[model samples]
Target: MSEYKFLTGLTSGFTPVIDAGFSLEDYRHIDLSVQNEILSQAQLDAPEAFQKYLDNFLLAQGGQIPWGGYNEHRGLYRRSGLFSAATEEDLIRNIHIGLDVWAPVGTGVLAVLDGRIHSFKDNNNFGDYGPTIILEHEFEAGKFYTLYGHLQRESLKDLQAGEKVKQGERIAALGDASENGNYAPHLHFQIIHDLQGKEGDYPGVANRKELEFYLSNCPDPNLLLKMN
Candidate 1:
């Protein structure tokens, strides 16, 4: 069995930007739990409000919503698995493999542990994350990696592959909607134990069929973030 450490300090120590003219604390007070409950109970309960949320998210990114959800398989994005002809034709399709912490643009992103830059890329697409970075760390008993997506372009200006990064190092900054692949500004953080022959990017989420493999390779980031 693997012993996990609670990454509480890092999650609590960072000050996250919540929204325009607001802080993360303020944004967290928006009663997302109630909203989620209402959404679960009846989609019609707050249709207009929900639409407004989507609109605001789209406006922030300066792009339209992608054909499907990038973080998870359920909710609004899963209604149509037919995002594109290519995706529809694929044997294995969209699966989210990360934890998305929605916040405002320009939020600071910090490294959770000491590591080296594994790989990175500017995966810009209508629904894709803008600037993404992955770090590889080898522990005493095993090797693992952490990925940060939807980062600002400037964050990558100074980083390079194989560069050493310290724990708690400011790795990147959150990108605005326009620069962050046209989605609401948020950090998609994932823990990847195996690359599974993938580089530059891996599935941030997975479909039900592939859930077992992904879950084994990608453990809960909250083990490191302790945000919950």
Candidate 2:
């Protein structure tokens, strides 16, 4: 099915990922580009450092979604060797495949649609999804999946594969540095048209070689969040 048709099916009563103090009016665009000023002045290697940057940005924007990350080529990942490739010939996966909703720790993460648990795992690494969950969804458009990464470890307790989760249901919570892949608190939301036989774990970044394929497979998540 077309991306527009799939997007239309995803827009519904999803729970807010941020605190009550925030709203659409408070949302601000973050620049992960090489020429970004705030990034130029800060170090993103440490989670606390990134948190400071997020705090300042939220204060400046009046506490809103620090939304931006789809296909963004960022230098922030340099802090972790996990993003490095053994051969220079292999394009480094710096382009983000998902839209990140930066918010505070413990923020409720709601399921965007009705689906069953597909898979989940604790991808513990320097730069990885600490606790991740993937849900399988089917609509008139087609069968697809929604992935939620950087979730609290406790969120995975008692969750079984194939368990049903209603739309707008609280499936997880935003995790902290100790649990969420050592990054700032945020929900990594991705749409996968095909898992390619994968389970709970999926590549959240793409390199130049496979950019075209991934870009088409994982459409912009803002199509569902609608938080432009």
Candidate 3:
């Protein structure tokens, strides 16, 4: 196989990092259901402070945070071991490796570039990414993979491994909370340079110690979507 194309010819604009020049206050009032979940779960009582932290974090990570008033605190829970007893395995599992774009159910999710369907499956479980799809793209000197999680069932109806997909194709649609493994509707976009012996499911998040490996394998997806 050719060294896969690292990055080229991707475009952005459909997804704005800051809600089309709207202020933080404006995002707060967008009336989306997921915003309520963010406010309640993330405890984002202070919008300005939260937004500042989110912006700074994304900038440092080489990606742009998506708009829509949802702030993703990657590695926070993993670092604190809030999900369970602080075990090495548990910690290694919670660090999120993808950029989650908060949006409503039924949102149209387009493919970032031309590629072949590498694999896909229905991952039904609590706190899991529901239905998912992974595409393998070949570029000039490199090959890469993109994973889309929490997608509606319709998205997977006719897709299959080795199927060809065009750039900007409507590969999948957003799933609702109930069908999306019990979380709010959102797109968990991830890039993987190496599958690392796993299939059907990849680490949507990781722990502190495993950060280096996950980050290296899963580069900032904004490189393709430019949705930030």
Global CA lDDT computed for model 2? 0.81
lDDT of 3 at 50: 41
Mind giving the per-residue lDDT tens digits that candidate 1 earns over 1-228? Answer: 153443333345433321223332332212222224544423312434444564564465554321122235434333333322234323344556676666546767877788999989887765566789999988765777888888999988977899998876778888986777655567778888888766667767465566777777787676665432
TM-score of 2: 0.91
> In lDDT terms, how accurate is model 3?
0.61
C-alpha lDDT of residue 77 in model 3 = 35
Winner on lDDT between 2 and 3 is 2
Off by over 4 Å in 1: 1-73, 76-95
For each candidate in the order shown, give its overall lDDT on alpha carbons.
0.61, 0.81, 0.61
After superposition, candidate 3 runs with Cα above 4 Å error? 1-92
Candidate 3: deviation at residue 50, Å? 14
In terms of lDDT, the poorest run of 10 residues in model 3 is: 26-35
